[model samples]
Target: MKIGELSRTTGVSIRSLRYYEQQGLITSVRQPNGYREYTLLTIETVETVKLYLNLGLTTEQIASFLTCVLQNKEAFCTEVMPVYRKKLAEIERQIVELNQIKANLIDRIAFLGQQEQGNDE
Candidate 1:
């Protein structure tokens, strides 16, 4: 398939796909005619890339995970678990901070409402 097919199938933009190639997140072979040739596996690889990217993993981190998985499937599964666990912990902390901000906004709204009612009296 061509890059357009990959983009259409993966729902990723062509620019993103090109960037992924530039970032070393993906690879393509060139034919004698200078056209980029992609394998059938490219589709699945793009999907995996999207999944890891959405999980907050950088391209380098995703590459490390891919290398580890290719080298040692079992240990990769075991060792990489903790990294994701840490990401989840950080997300939890962010959620807590966001919740506090939300509560502060609610309190400010209530205070402003009270002041408005006071002005009417």
Candidate 2:
């Protein structure tokens, strides 16, 4: 199939598909007319890429172990553990920071409410 067909089949835009190719996350063959041709198997790879991206994995990170995942050899993709741990740590840190910000905002709002009550007295 051609690039358009792949995009339609995968529900990913042509631009993004090209970007995936450029990132070496996916691949295609150049036809004689300069059009790109893709294999049916590429559909699975694209879906896998989408899954990883939704999990907050970057293309660079996905590339490290995508082949292992596609081949159903995830247990052998040791690189996935470090990346998953790193991403989880980052998310945890952000959650802590956001909690702090939320607490501060709540305190500020209460203080403002107290001042408003005093002014009304």
Candidate 3:
């Protein structure tokens, strides 16, 4: 299929597909007419890229995992575990920070309520 067909199949925009190719997350062959020809597998590849992006993985990170997966699906787990662990730790840290912010917001709300009540009294 062509780039347009791949984009339609994957529901990804043409610009994003081009960016993915530029980032080495995906690839395509150029036809004689200067059009990009994509294999059927490109659909799944694009979906995987999208999934990784949604998981907060950068294009560079996705490229590493994609390289491993393409090289050997069996080796993917062993090779990608460290990346996953690191990302998980980052997410955990963000969660902790967000929880602290939430607590502060709640405290402020409570303090404002108490002040309002005191003013009424």
Candidate 4:
């Protein structure tokens, strides 16, 4: 379909889609009129790119992973495995830090509650 249709369908802006193409994360064909045409598979790839982006993966990492997926198709143990594992570990570490902050907030709230009750008494 056209770029606008793809953008509307994927909820990604045309600028971002073009950026994806420029980043080599997606493939498109140029029509005779200079308009770009996209395939359904491209939409799927864009969704995958969005997922990685949401996880804070860099453009380089996402491009490499997408390339790996495109080349090996059947090879599951390629470079993407190690890359994704490392990313997952980093995410886990961040989650731990976030949880610590949440716990600290809870403790502070309880302490403030106690102080307010004391003041009231």
The count of residue-pair clashes in candidate 4 stands at: 0
C-alpha displacement of 79 in model 4, angstroms? 1.0
The prediction achieving the highest TM-score against the true structure is 2
Better of 1 and 3 by lDDT: 3
Q: Which stretches of candidate 1 lie over 4 Å from their true place?
A: 69-76
Please rank every candidate by TM-score, starting with the best.
Answer: 2, 3, 1, 4
- Pull out the clashing pairs in model 3: none
lDDT of every model, 2 decimals: 0.81, 0.94, 0.87, 0.85
lDDT of 4 by residue, 1-121 (tens): 8999999999999999999889888888999999999999888888878887897888888877686675566267377777778899998999999999999999999999999999998
Clashing residue pairs in all predictions, respectively, total 0, 0, 0, 0
lDDT of 3: 0.87
- Candidate 2: RMSD over Cα atoms? 1.4
> Where does candidate 4 have its weakest 10-residue lDDT segment?
68-77
Q: Is candidate 1 or candidate 3 better by TM-score?
A: 3
Question: Model 1: per-residue lDDT, tens digit, 1-121?
Answer: 7888888889999898888888777789988987677888778778878888899977776775764554566364665787678788989999999999999999999999999999999
Q: Which stretch of 10 consecutive residues in model 1 shows the poorest summed lDDT?
A: 67-76
Model 4: residues with Cα > 4 Å off, grouped in runs: 30-34, 39-41, 54-56, 74-77
